[model samples]
Target: MAHNEKLALLIVLPSLLAGCTSAQMNMLTGKRNKTYNDVNAPWVGSTEEQLISKWGPPKKSYTLESGAKIISYEDMWGPISAYHVCVEKFMIEKGIVTKWGISNCPTRIKGSLPKDTPIPQPTL
Candidate 1:
């Protein structure tokens, strides 16, 4: 390859590699970095009321055509933040928690709960 081409590759290669490394790290430690305050272990059967009582209020929620409900919560870390900032989702069906997951980070979703939605006081 030409000298200029080699030089360009040298500069770009590190950035490309860094991006890949960051993605891999997120996949590996994503769940461990989540912050769950309300519901306890073995979350499969926990009810929506139980979750609200523990984690205050969710940032957003939705109801699907199949009647399943999804509630999301965010962990805000003040001003400075990192990839560790995350949003967690709880799947509820028939008044019972069925599944849950954590995303790499949080993002605003259109039509989400209004900013004024009341966050329930923590019961603990």
Candidate 2:
């Protein structure tokens, strides 16, 4: 690769890594919050049954053709307050979780709803 290209990568890569680290720290410290579900509370390592017990039933649950379990939780953001959906894909193998992911998620979900405004009912 050209010298300029290599130099740019060296500068850009560290900046990108630093940005991600800061975001992660903010998330952990609650300095930055993600409005999906609850910023103070997020999905953690727990059994499917435990999750259900706490969050109540998910909006949608399905087994993929490959047998992955996908559970969707509906949340919202903004004044006109468009509906926002947060789906966590659980990778279960042999009845145990292998991994999970947040799909199509933004860096943050913001809302201006009243404190008394109930969480939107999931239309799943």
Candidate 3:
């Protein structure tokens, strides 16, 4: 790599890790909020049953001809005006989780959304 590129990376990497992430920090837990990567990394070699036990039932589960199964978990919370959705998929081979990924999850970076919208929060 060029000297300029290395300097640029050195300057940019810290800022990105400091706050550019979409993940929030949990007040109660004092831990970084769970992102798909953070939550699923440990489950890479875990069994399907073990995953299910921790995460409860998946939203959907199906198998491919290759004998690898995929388990998906989706969660959307908050009101219609401001909600978040993420569908996390895990690949299970021989009943053990081998790989996992998010098919289509949309997230607003911090400060991307307006704090004070003209529309008020609706009460049910």
Candidate 1: tens digits of C-alpha lDDT, residues 2-121: 999999999998787676643354454442222242232246688888888888788999999999998888775436644355677888899888887766543322222223433222
Please tell me which model should have the higher lDDT, number 1 or number 2.
1
The TM-score values for the models, in the order shown, are 0.48, 0.41, 0.55
RMSD of each: 13.7, 14.9, 15.1
lDDT of each: 0.62, 0.53, 0.67
lDDT by residue (22-105, candidate 3, tens digit) is 434233224333334545566888999999999999999998999999888997866789876777888899999988776345
Candidate 1 ranges beyond 4 A from true positions: 1-41, 78-84, 105-124
Worst 10 residues of 3 by lDDT: 115-124
In model 1, what lDDT does residue 12 have? Answer: 97
Off by over 4 Å in 3: 1-34, 103-124
Cα error of candidate 2 at position 2, Å: 60
Give the number of the best model, judged by lDDT: 3
Residues 5-117, candidate 2: write the lDDT tens digits. Answer: 99999999877767675446565455554343343233444667766676677777778788767665665433455655546454444344445555444555553333443
Instruction: Supply candidate 2's per-residue lDDT for 105.
Output: 49
Which ranking of candidates, highest lDDT first? 3, 1, 2
